[model samples]
Target: NLKIILGHMGEGLPYSMWRIDNRNAWVKTEPNYPAKKRIADYFHSNFWLTTSGNFRTQTLVDAMLEIGSDRILFSADWPFENVDHAAEWFDTASISENDRIKIGRTNAARLFKLEA
Candidate 1:
């Protein structure tokens, strides 16, 4: 399987996801998308989102609820964005400890197959 990581929560891909899914669900005409499942479904299965420099609690909560935490990775833009800021925000995000840990480190390790 090709590991795909999406930067900046796919740079508003989630909004497009909602639009695609909504359109596909409501419209009955022969759709242009040939996928077997909805766009959001594909996203859930194939894509990973990184927080990077976009660190907003509401956005994080929204994404976590919309897609999930397993595919969300913690990242710092560095030079441009401070690692300390990211860490600080992450440490206090509204998500649970388990989800926080998953997004913060475990998920990345699992995705990259890092041991220890």
Candidate 2:
């Protein structure tokens, strides 16, 4: 029903995923799922991420973004960053509008796939 492109994964919240997944102590109680599952199950080829906010290069954020923009959306991180900041980096981000559409909201419509 939906899709996106993953670029610069490990660009966000992925390393943390490893931490959560590897937590033997936590796994003992919540054996059904891992802290990262809420985020990782979303992974798909169509899922995409832009290098926009690689500023922090948070593996968790990047990995999560790679999992899908549905979880990660493009933000200029304004005040702390800028619109052009995201735009400039995104220009060469190496993903497509099929994925871009999601970041731009076209994919949102399809997810919500609204008629309006």
Against the true structure, what is every candidate's RMSD? 1.8, 6.8
Deviation in angstroms for 18 in model 2? 2.6
Window of ten residues with lowest summed lDDT in model 2: 55-64
Writing each residue's lDDT as its tens digit, candidate 2 over 37-78 gives 344455443345544445343442354444655544555546
Candidate 2, residue 36: lDDT: 48
TM-score (all chains, Cα) for each model: 0.86, 0.49
**Model 1 stretches astray by more than 4 angstroms:** 27-29
lDDT per residue (tens digit) for residues 2-61 in model 1: 567887766888668888788889887877767888878888788888998889988888
lDDT of 1 at 35: 83
> What does the lDDT read for residue 4 in candidate 2?
59
In angstroms, the error of model 2 at 46 is: 18
The candidate that wins on TM-score is 1
